[model samples]
Target: MEINKKSQAGSLESSDLMVYVEPFNEIKIEVESSVSSQHTEEIRSLILNELEMRKINGVYVKIQDNGAMNLTIKARLKTALLRGAKNGN
Candidate 1:
């Protein structure tokens, strides 16, 4: 059976990021980093992976990272995806 994925709880710290995981949408990304390019890349990669894993396609993602760690970024992305998926955003 195809289980419907619902939006998960959002994190207050990563509340700034708005990621939409649905059909027919754009992938928008914006970063506010005091970190290095490599770190940013890592976070970006992780986000992409998370989206793919959730089987979500065609959506825009806006990330405003404030020197957050990799795990934190992932959590934020997950929350956004869950929210978007559940709310049909």
Candidate 2:
């Protein structure tokens, strides 16, 4: 799926994550987390896995995490990707 414009999902509240996606020539990801020193790689892996599973590429993703768990992160990324796909269509 192609992200046509900026789209977002989730919240900045504790235990939640906000995900933003937009169209790009190549995939670019930026992540900010309350526990970046600990969970940054894990979080990036989760997001990349989700995108790969959906065959999504050529997009820019920005994640703002507030201590969210893995499941929450996956759900939020899926939500944002779906929303972005809809916008593209």
Query: Which ranges of candidate 1 are over 4 A from the true structure?
Result: 1-28, 87-89
Pick out the ten consecutive residues of candidate 1 with the lowest summed lDDT. 1-10
What are the per-residue Cα lDDT tens digits for candidate 2 across 42-89? Answer: 898888888888888788999999999999999888888878885542
| lDDT tens per residue, model 1, 12-69 | 3532333333333444444444556776677677776876787666655656565666
In the order shown, what is each candidate's alpha-carbon RMSD?
5.1, 1.7
lDDT of each candidate versus the true structure: 0.55, 0.86
Clashes of each: 4, 0
lDDT of 1: 0.55
Q: Candidate 2 at residue 6, lDDT?
A: 76
lDDT of 2 at 11: 99
- Candidate 2 yields a Cα-based lDDT of 0.86
Indicate which candidate wins on lDDT. Answer: 2
